[model samples]
Target chain A: MSGIQKNIIKTLLLIALFMLSENMNAQTCCAAGAPIGSYLEIQTGDKRLFSFQFRYEYNNVNRLVENENRIENDPRTRYGQSFLWKLDFSLNKKLAFSAIVPFVHQSRNTISEQQSSFGIGDFSFITQYTHFKGRFRSLNISAGIKFPTGKTNHRADSQILLSPDMQSGTGSFDFIFRSSASKTFSSLPFLTSYASALFRLNGMNNDFGSTSTFVGRQFAFGDEVNSQIGARYLLTLKSGFLTPDIGLKIRWANHNLEQQQAAPNSGGYWLSLPLGVSFAPNEKKSIAFTAELPLYQKLSGLQITTAFRLGFQINYTFQKNKTDDILN
Target chain B: MKNLLFLTILLLFGCNKDDNQAQTDWLIPFDEVLDGGPGKDGIPSVDAPQFDNVSDISFLNDNDLVIGMFHNGVSKAYPHQILDWHEIVNDDLSDISYALTYCPLTGTGIAWDRVIDGSKTSFGVSGKLYNTNLMPYDRATDSYWSQIRLDCVNGTQINKVINTYPIIETTWSTWKAAYPNSEVMNLTTGSNRNYGSYPYGDYRTNHSNIIFPVSNTDDRLPAKERALIVMGDQTKKVYSIELFAEDRAIEDTIDGTTIIVIGSKSKNFIVAYEKGNLTEVVAVTDQLPTIATDTNGNRINLDGTIESGPLQDVQLTTFNSFIGYFFALGAFYEVEIYE
Candidate 1:
């Protein structure tokens, strides 16, 4: 069977596994996720390549605490699910382009109240340059911009503007910078490792005056920094190869400012462990899945905690000289 | 700056704007109701409220505001500090379902019967404000009702009049003093919110700054003037809280229905009751605030009891009255001020 057909079967199996696990246990709660962590492998061939990736993430926010104590008598909780589609184009060995499109659904439940929202989320575009390549390693640097392309004025059943966190997008411009490096061990050639750091500088949405129920006229989100390191070892089989990976990710965010004032319960830090697997039936196609579980979390104020973050991606590489490319 | 402006234009045109058309017959124009904040179900209503005896409430200060209700032989209190955050509470007392609503903007506290056409339904905040008053939507039919208007302005129950019950907007001290055994809502509301501070900064004290606009304003009273309001079948009347504080008693007629208003501003308690018979009234006691006197020379107590007349010990029937800012009354009614 071709790689595409084989990856499809593996994708279905992973989905079944996720369903079984989800039905067996409930995840813990907290919130915060962005489209990230793909494109770690830099292309080396002379032919241009195109890759498509999809990711699903869930964040649960339950506790709104102050001073680490759960605030009593207010039961406003939210769960956010996001689906992201990313396209990457490696035009040559030195240059690449990428874009992320997201859709989000948020559900809120109070003591006796519940509400939900579904819509397109923010979109991001990025450009990258490969600075160096060696027999065993590669280095790349990237810069990106995110546009406020989603609805920010969704209302509750009460005809009030939803809290900023519940909306599909932040309604702000964000600038992003990232650097990544990957190395293969010649002594143990089956092992490959990579590390990356990403930073986001957020802008403000000044339209909260007409859209907000609270007193704030403007809403500005906090800046964010994320660092991740992972390693994978390949296991060759008769039909394909299986790469099992383990990673650690750390995220830090500054407190969000509202109307130029520090908004309460708005920022925090999280440490997570990512466990993943990639199945490659051939070089041109692969299916990968990752599950992230937070090991430690300390928020500056009360916030919804993230129970687990899960991602799935099916990557297909199209080579210029391939039969598929000629047919197209 | 040029790059920023170009990006801003792209951002503005990239998303779809919400355009919901009016679907029901409205007493006021739909544009009059503006967005308050928090998307739909953003400020969730308390579905299952927890309660404790008045003595168990240690968080409430003497002057902290609370909405008091006596229904089906039960007395319950909902604090403004709590209601300000949630907006609505769907609760049942002695098997009768009721919705307790408070609009911080209009300073109106009302308890509504949750039954319409013999069916029980609950309410949620519609995230909408009419004349700075809360507009609640019934869950069963998704019809939006103006709290002050007491009518469903849109949706399946359009133009439907909601049944209202009586509640007293008073201070915590006054409510506890009167109904010492009453059940006060507990602060341990299984959610997260600061139950101590008012969410809207300095709103209770700010009189001149109107954040949301109302269609009409009556300069007869200050915009935030608190008053006792009585709603009859066709007419509505207001007894100024200041007048109730000064006279300690107000006897008036609305559309020929005789009513008496009494309360203590210092004590933070005010109530109105329907009068059934011929009456003469006077304020005779300084120590206890015994203000009512009948034609037959009987002193009546603030609890509507006739003190010395032939009908001594007889209690007058209390009306379903509530306290509101004059601005809210003007927003909903052609109100007659009791002279």
Candidate 2:
């Protein structure tokens, strides 16, 4: 056997290993801050490299569902849009740090009432480390903390405080853990397969609806697990590389707890398929567009679930040249 | 530099200010009114409800609770399975229009006349709660009415009291056996909802589960235990269904007025009426519209109607009474338990 064939075998083995380790947990049913996984895709390079990315996301939730069945003709609908800015700095070949800031706007509409809220969302800071690096595959692990920076006490036009799901932030400090792996085969040099899993351990917000009293005011978003697997193929162009990717994502969340009891219609499992295309004009800049469609959902109780999601991202990298490194 | 400026501008645009808040002059304490998660009409009300004969209905379990109403020689049953999803049902029968309102959190059900000041209008769930009970709103005047308070607490019709009708809430099997020819509200409520499922999980049986804060808490009985409460001038008395282990009746004087309470624990029903001429009342069985009889040969039904004897077809004036969760009754009124 040649070295190329050996590399292909190694890549296939890595893919199989990660696929078997995928964790299947549940997800929350309402709008939240953008998942940390969306901003964890950092490119491994030399030290002193810095990158910035901005993303816009739009989600529409209108389908009223009970368990796995869709209840048709529901007039209630919710729309969420978010703008996120992310910054990344590489300390070495194996270590990196990232920070993200988000702004979110949400609206819910029925035949008789319309409510909209907008504000700054929660902020997150993550530290990622490259655990394994080989010619055929690489593995990255990340851990982060989310701050309760968003406004949770926003009231509606009627002066009634909006529900937790409608607020821009969760009002709770949360912990996020993720592991991602990517592989490239020698026979298919332009194709790459990747898999990632993320788990968010949520904290409790003692001042969920009212800041005045704590008797029955505690609210905690359910912990969530999101996993995805996919492959991307790159097409080389004269000025850039155009890459198209598709993936199957499974998300599961436990029911939210209100006053130490599980809240109804709050959490469930969701399976979605995401497709995206990215254009890297050069190594320093890239733009990507993605669309996610929910294929199946089994919510804990009755809830309005996501119909579809659209996202656009722009990335810019600042490279540290030899002269800059010498100056430092 | 330009990119950062543009992003800063975008983030500034995301911060919104609400300057068009609706001015509310609430008759009740405004801070006590809490949002029930779903917005107004989020839990849609049944406007043009569909019905099926009791024999044709199959979605309800034998032990499932129902709200039964009788008027103009016709009987109807509204299952809690349906009411658990749609808390209000607006219906008309033989020129009588009323709304059946049930609050899942508080476990209280009442029937209110749809006519307000001689104008007919339907009611919708306001998605607001007082003492964790439902607050319904009239479609005509957009006024919020407390289900347990039986009065408008907000909007144009503040402080207006609604007239209520008498209803007997019992198990589906018991109601079906007594009123087999009754019409039941079916699942075809036009709005798609899961009628087979109880929306609140374990809330009916969990003694310690109270989702929202109550103004008053009573540990005399479990919070979710159902009891019949009769309201008088500045007085409220509670009669636990468990007190009637067998078919029995109790004559008690409350607020200087004599009242008769008839109930059966096995049948899961309790009804009360002002004692005017009722004498020698005793429990009877297997007679439709005749759960009790008197020595004067008068057969009394669940609706306090006299079916025979000297007062045939005459209706007994009922005291303001209804079945509610013990915690809810305690929250609204300082209730005295009838031993």
Clashes (backbone N, CA, C under 3 Å), per candidate, total 38, 5
Q: List the residue pairs that clash in candidate 2.
A: A25-A252, A26-A252, A26-A253, A27-A252, A27-A253
Task: Name the top DockQ candidate.
Answer: 2
Residue A262, model 2: lDDT of 84
> Residue by residue across A226-300, what tens digits does model 1's lDDT show?
898999888897888788889899988887765565655567787889888888776766677877887777777
Residue by residue across A1-328, what tens digits does model 2's lDDT show? 4463354345434432332221011011123565556567666565678877777788888778889999897868888877777888877768889988776667777777887766667889989898866656889899999999876656666676667787778989999999998888999987888899999999998866553332436778899999999988888899887999899999999988877788877789999999999987767667889989999998988988889989988776776432111100
- Model 2 regions lying over 4 Å from their true place: A1-32, A211-216, A320-328, B2-24, B286-288
lDDT, model 2, position B128: 83
Model 2: CAPRI class: incorrect
Task: Please state how well chain A of candidate 2 matches the true chain A, as a TM-score.
Answer: 0.86
Of the candidates shown, which would achieve the greatest TM-score relative to the real structure?
2
Q: Score the docking of each candidate (DockQ).
A: 0.09, 0.22
User: TM-score for all predictions?
Assistant: 0.65, 0.90
